[model samples]
Target: MDSTALDLGEDNSLLLVDDDEAFLRRLAKAMEKRGFAVETAGSVAAGQAIATGRPPAYAVVDLRLEDGNGLDVVETLRARRPESRIVVLTGYGAIATAVAAVKIGATDYLAKPADATDVTNALLARTDTLPPPPENPMSADRVRWEHIQRVYELCDRNVSETARRLSMHRRTLQRILAKRSPR
Candidate 1:
């Protein structure tokens, strides 16, 4: 380890981007201990700068940043390193955005409050296999409701657009969105 850079080398290089200073610093240390040579950025531009210079083998990027969307960072990294394993983290989870991330080369998408363990599992999981089923699956009704909510968010919460895409009447979609979802 270069006491200063803590760099292990290229194969294990990691980039972590998040506007949350505390979380970024914490994860950096945790990842370093796990054998990655970690580098971190707090905003999209900074993250892009580092990614452009040397796209790491792995990355963890927040979906929303103060300056711009973190998806932009993911795109930059993917463009620079096609084989890089990138994980997208978001406080607001939406199916549309998740699909967008995967389409653009993100290896995985995780909702906010993910721990080091969760991130590690996602980062290293085989891309070819399906993830194991949820320990406690959501009820069919709840699943339906969640899918509706995801589409609604993807449509920027525009009731008309969501209704149009869902092929349902505006009033019906509105009623579904308005109802409290089942826990």
Candidate 2:
């Protein structure tokens, strides 16, 4: 209708996945009206199937699905179709989850209920900076901390075996423990 709208037409192909049937249909139609060649899937399995068959240029994945977490779908799509940009959406979005998504492989993360324009911008903006996704946002440090905390609870704060199981020197584990304890 306007020049800006006309300019937005070129990048359109998208694969949209959500568990809510009505929401999925409405989004599909809205994206279509905006010139996207949109495909809709109501479950993770269906979305994975569609992606494997004919991968789109981008994807919009909800955080939770009827069958499973949408992160699994995102992982599958990222593995099978690396070129496809991914934008993760969640109705229960939090800072940690949003950061994790972005750090993992998402081009962008949105808090639903996101409008059609919100979705489009995220999918389209994938081109601006193509950073390689981190191998794991939950880094070894974080994992070690969690493991130590778990072992500490199980072993009643025993420092020896936790360090052994964690495959680190007792001194190193103690240093980590010191950080965790109150100063």
Identify the candidate with maximal TM-score.
1
Give candidate 1's error at residue 134 in angstroms.
5.4
Question: What total of clashing residue pairs does each candidate reach?
Answer: 0, 0
Q: Write the per-residue lDDT of candidate 1 for residues 1-183, one digit (tens) a residue.
A: 121333334599899999999999988988877778889999999999999998999999999999999999999998999989999998778899999999999999998667776777788788888767555666889767877888899899999999999999999998988889986
lDDT of 2 by residue, 1-183 (tens): 211332444555689999888988988888778777888888889988987888777889998887988887787787777867899998766788888777667888987667787777677664567544433355667655665787777677888977777677999878888895331
* Candidate 2 weakest lDDT stretch, 10 residues: 1-10
lDDT score at residue 63, model 1, on the 0-100 scale: 95
Off by more than 4 A, model 2: 1-11, 126-183
